[model samples]
Target: MPPINVIRNALVAGSAERRPAVLWALASLALSMLLSSLGTSIANVGLPTLAQAFSASFQEVQWVVLAYLLAITTLIVGVGRIGDIIGRRRLLLAGIVLFSVASLLCGVASTLGQLIAARAAQGCGAAIMIALSMALVGEAVPQARTGSAMGLLGTMSAIGTALGPSLGGVLIAGFGWRAIFLVNVPLGLLTFLLARRHLPVDRRGPQTERAGFDTLGMLLLALTLAAYALAMTMARSHFGPLNIALLLAAAIGAGLFVRVEVRATAPLIDLAIFRDPGLRAGLAMSALVATVIMTTLVVGPFYLARALGLDAPFVGLAMSAGPLAAALSGVPAGRSVDRFGAPRMTIVGLIGVAAGSCMLSVLPTRLGISGYLAPMIVITASYALFQTANNSAVMTATRPAQRGVNSGMLGLARNLGLITGASVLGAVFALAAATPDIATAPPEAIARGMRITFAVAALLAAIALTIAVASRAVATRPVRDEFSVGK
Candidate 1:
């Protein structure tokens, strides 16, 4: 088989290649993305089942999900840097194997704590897969086709997210909770084989690999991120003393991390990278848009069940629509970026998201479910467009040596936005409902809360749009036909 990842091979070996090989390679990567997201969403559906099986409380069972999220949030960037320093292919292979073994462990675990630990291990594998998979896109495809590649990966992620709860439900019903995790073992094996055959060969030698490794910086960054994520998630909508303490620790850790990075000879993340206008804007916009998108997930179920009086099955159906729309939109959105240029498409996408959010904010519950679902579909589809374009822009403009870290940062921003949205916007919903106990809030109150949450979501999208426009306005160079806004 010809090398599917031939960006450097074309130059180094002077070898001709067929497009089919690239497709095969891309299939491996797309599957990796799908599995990582599936790991996240599939476990959620099994929470109740696992809780009952393990004789544990809901809070205790939640750690099955939390451990995975915490592992990914804290370790993604650090592992991405490791990929850059050592070699992406090797690290990715190790991650795949680790993830597969961890899945088996999770499935067979007899106790709750053991399962949680296995999930954390599974998360580490996911972090590597997510980080390096995106990083390797530059090597796997032509620069001009970056948007399309990014879009394909985005589509797989959406499909995984959309498929998870329903798929998990089926598996749990048929074979039990263990089946949910055991499913990944076969899938992981396939991905490993495919990736081994198709992934690009790492050409970097070991000369500088050990030199200037910033172990301290990595530790500090991971701890800081962990602190912040725990702070936002542990307290939920209620801010308690523990939340305050974690937040303060996170703040301090962040300060010290910056201090360490600036002084380090080789930083885990170069502090200077944020200086580029396009890159800076891309990361910020990604975080903001992600925050807005998360509002749909956070607020939609409540609105559907309470305000619109939908049944449980209908609530799930309606909830799936946004991700389904996103899954369908991804490829076309990528083609649009490839055709129109990432800069222009980025703005168009953000406008669509902001418009959708605005409509949702003012939507009258009198129109009922259609009123809510319509705007949500628009928001998710537009978000797919924005995400593809933004990722393409950032990765295309980034240097080859730094691509891994940049991709990790983009993923980090999105993850942080999601965690924050779940905590912060959930609070906004409760506050708007004018009730401490949202569970008992009346229908009209739920309607009010939904509207207010979307209004806040709209504002967040607007802020992201403003950032995009401002970045383009002050761009240091002329508009190019590709993803570049600024170097």
Candidate 2:
């Protein structure tokens, strides 16, 4: 609401002399994480209503969600690198404003096309927020507290995701589909104010681009990510000719991207960063774990309703157990990581997840909803631990100067994992079910599909566990307690 200089000067003059602003700063970061995740999830509930209102098919209305995802996927990493070159504070503030303004446009748009375009803009803002929020944690909290800070942000993210569907349903039912987007306006403004008031000022220096980096790498990476994302999402559960062509293009683009990055003066992503064993393991495990988690979301509903004979409301309630568990476990998970160390905690989390997946695979349907719910709770809570540890390890491993791009890389990994799970794992479910139309599949088929899917999920978790254990052995230099915390 106030000019940047006025607020900056006021906070600078008073803060530390009067009161510590650490709590407020963390709160602002937490809110930014929340808003970014909410932007991701809250739109799905509107598709049916949007289709009816616009007289469009489900496929047509789907773009409202797809555009937002594609925008984030393509631009997230590039924006993060840009933030490093410029100033994170400036970029984050701009992102909050853009996201807020886009929400307003989304609410007021008269046509679906306009709404989709606005959603894309909002996704760009979200990309910036998600990337920079994690990057700025070092400035907001002490090294000793990084784990807890990461945990809090993780909790907020889970809460945002868990809250979106239920909140969207209420807003749409009471006001209209428009209300869902409109609600973000006030929250975004508050986040902006808190951020402007509390976040540490971006260090004043003559900033220089790493090596006068041109835009080619970013463009190439975006197109490559875009092609892969489209391949995964454009035809859900169907790997048709188009999907194959897109996949080929993505592969070629990836090869070209690597070649370009290797030659660039200031590469968007430093290829050398991946040489760190712990950091590489963290990113790879994050993707693998995300894929496992997404499989639950995709397959859980059908298993609950069809296999367990639950009603619609019961199904919704049951399906929520995973997110709720994730939200509840986040803070504790972070604390554990901080106390026992991220590498150790990461292994523990993977084991828990693997155990839960095994339970899901073998537990008989005769045991009913309890069997399904129990395994989900275990998986979610364990995932919370893994996410916090992996994130903290990865962030701490990177130098401060490169944190933004590295953080963006973490997000990109998770996004790709989600996309992969939705397509590849979804196909696995369909095949295991042995049904052309999953919607009409009998209860036995649904149950069978769920079991088979989770068996595969457990195997994936085992693979992640293998990677984590193996990474520790390969670590030439263990991650220094996040830059020697408390030293």
Candidate 3:
């Protein structure tokens, strides 16, 4: 057989034999993300049905969604490390099987507890798939096409995310909530079959022993994230002194987790990835973008449904524009990044997003659906570009051996950004509406307060754009990392 160096070089050079496998891997990765993202958004629309079926309140039933998110966030880094230690293909297949079974369990769940438990399992499976998906693409495909392929995959995820609510609404309105869980069976089965057959084997030689898994680091990280999530979930509600104490304890736990990673031999998360200029900037930019994107999403539904008095169906239709635009831009932005490089494409996209936010922020109190749709498209499309470039930059900076763990950390950073964005924006919105004179204030005053939130989002994007531009300048000097791009 050819040497390991030969295979590595071929991968860097975009060899013919590797391209086909890369494409297949990208397809499977995108499909898996679609399923996981779809499950989250779709269930939101079906929450009322689930609530009634389980005899639960809105707050209680929310666990069905939160459990999945928390589980995924907590385990993604650890499971990703596992993928690195074992083989990505092996873990990917196992994740798919687990996800499928969890979905089935969720569908047949007779109570809220059962459903939440099932969702948690589903999240664990999702973490495995999500962490490995990008690594698989990076490993199998050549460097040149990485950006474009990732963009297409991002598009698939965005489409699934956007469609989930509408699909869930339609299903619940017609066939009932069970359909949402059942819908995954066919998709899951197909994904598993394709993955089992088409996913390539690990490139690491048989004699190349695996690294020891970081079990302690994994547990500490999980506990920390759980605590942080709990704190956020309780922030909006009235809590006792003991609850606040627990939240503070969780914060300390997170701090300890960070310290552990800095000193560990084989950290579940490779903290050194933070030192790379391109990577550091790219991750910060991606997180800022996520914060802006998610905040806007959180506020949009409230304004359309409650403030504007739009019907439920109409609100869903109106809100669909953003995701649609995001999905549409993913592949194109990706291709542009590969052709012209990352920074320019990312800045342009962030500017577009900022503009969209400004437009939405100033939307008249008496605005029509057209008012919202136009800005929504701009904001969504801009985010699509940001996501594609940010992901490309992160992946390109890391070596093949550490890709899985790095990808997991990247995913975690992005998810944390998302959670922070939603929380902060919600707080801003609530505070604005809670002013002493709010009842007497003009409708425009309320809109102005919302505008402040949007302005903050815009500022976040602008900062990200600045970093992206700097990173772009750095990328042009032809100084590729030895473990990364150039062989």
Candidate 4:
């Protein structure tokens, strides 16, 4: 027997022995979440600087971020499936190592293409880190405590987001953009070491029961997401054969992926999960919430910098408000979800988001930092409320054996929303202002574009609110002892 298996058996047989392992595993996972979340937000703050440094057009430079997102979105489900077959602990450790190396490469890249490639590699690692983090938390913590555990994890994510921009600003201003990536190296190394030492061994499914990897499904899914992202991102570019080709490919890929998933013995994503209305509604709302959050992330900075004439530090400070609000609200929201159930909280939270969006859409153009702060706080606080409750709802509805893939699906929805939000909201801004690049567009044009984008986001929030209103409530289920080894 493997050493990890021995450890797992010993820990499972002794309740006192399990506590330290659980704490260590949870702590490691929380740190991993924080590190990965920090990387997600930090890159956004450097977009303008990167464009300037590379002398690349905004459309060209946007690929730096888009490439990362696309890679994660395309591969996360497949990676999550792999985690169940092998072990999440092993995969997570490998992911940390890969992320660290990719960060080093990104910091040293001399060209835009090299940076973009490195960022994609980083995203690949990020997919593993993200897909398994929540699943691992679920496996390690008791069912009764799962809500609070998830809340703490959510708070860590919010803290990372809260710190990212301000940290990015200080790093970029003092040390240059490379510091943002280089800094990850040391942190990644630490996380990798801790994860290797502390993360629990996987011993869930029998080896004979695990199916072969769905290679074809993964390929089709990748093509579908990549082509769709390209089509959306390049919609503002002059019409061309290449653009039309991408759209056609996306359409074909989507049709084929669905067909393959429906027929496969073990699909990359199990389509059957959607049959549960509560899970379905939770996922739908998750995507929309992420869309609203990312739209602000992608669009708000430009508006603040251009229309309000703030510098990187000031812009970073203003942007920090949202995540700070999210961090502050995450725990309370999670407790609320535990006590009151997810459905009611989701409805209330969605309303808050819609109201915040409306406020942002109508705010005056020249109110300085204070004006942006209030709307941002409101939007993000609502996001915290929605996300904590909605996530609890989704997890409660899913079976223990399906946690890895389900968590992957949840992440997939988020990244997909992010991809769509960045592309659609960006396109809206561009078309509204009649410009290809908001970075260089006139302040009035940016202001007009921002308003339109926020209004659209508000509409999206309303749609999610409607879905939550009609969805079934999630019932709290007892944790199965067979699946509760760590707990």
Error of 1 at 206 (Å): 9.2
Residue pairs in candidate 4 whose N, alpha carbon or C atoms collide under 3 angstroms: none
lDDT digits (tens) for residues 1-487 of candidate 1: 1223322222222125646566767778888999999999999999999989999999999999999999999999988888888888888989999999999999999999999999999999999999999999888777777887888888889988999999999999999999999999999999999889988888685565434668999999999999999999987747999999999999999999999999998899988888898999999999999889888888888888887878999999999999999988887788888889898899999999999998998774756778888888989999999999999999999887788888889999999999999999988998999977777778989989988888999999999999999988877345563447444
Candidate 1's clash total is 0
- TM-score for every candidate vs. truth? 0.94, 0.93, 0.89, 0.85
Superposed Cα deviation of residue 163, candidate 4 (Å): 2.7
lDDT of each: 0.88, 0.86, 0.77, 0.80
Ranking by lDDT: 1, 2, 4, 3
lDDT of 2 by residue, 313-386 (tens): 88888878898898878877877877898888989999999999999987747577788889999999999999
Enumerate residue pairs that collide in model 3: none
Return the TM-score for candidate 3, rounded to 2 decimals.
0.89
The count of backbone overlaps in candidate 2 is 0
Q: Could you tell which candidate, 1 or 4, scores higher by lDDT? A: 1
Instruction: Report the C-alpha lDDT of model 3 over 278-370, residue by residue, as the tens digit.
Output: 878877877788888887677777667656667877877888888888877777777888888766777888889888888877763546567
Model 2 is weakest, by summed lDDT over 10 consecutive residues, at 1-10
Error of 2 at 258 (Å): 0.8
Q: Pick the candidate with the highest lDDT.
A: 1
Angstrom error at residue 66, model 1? 0.5
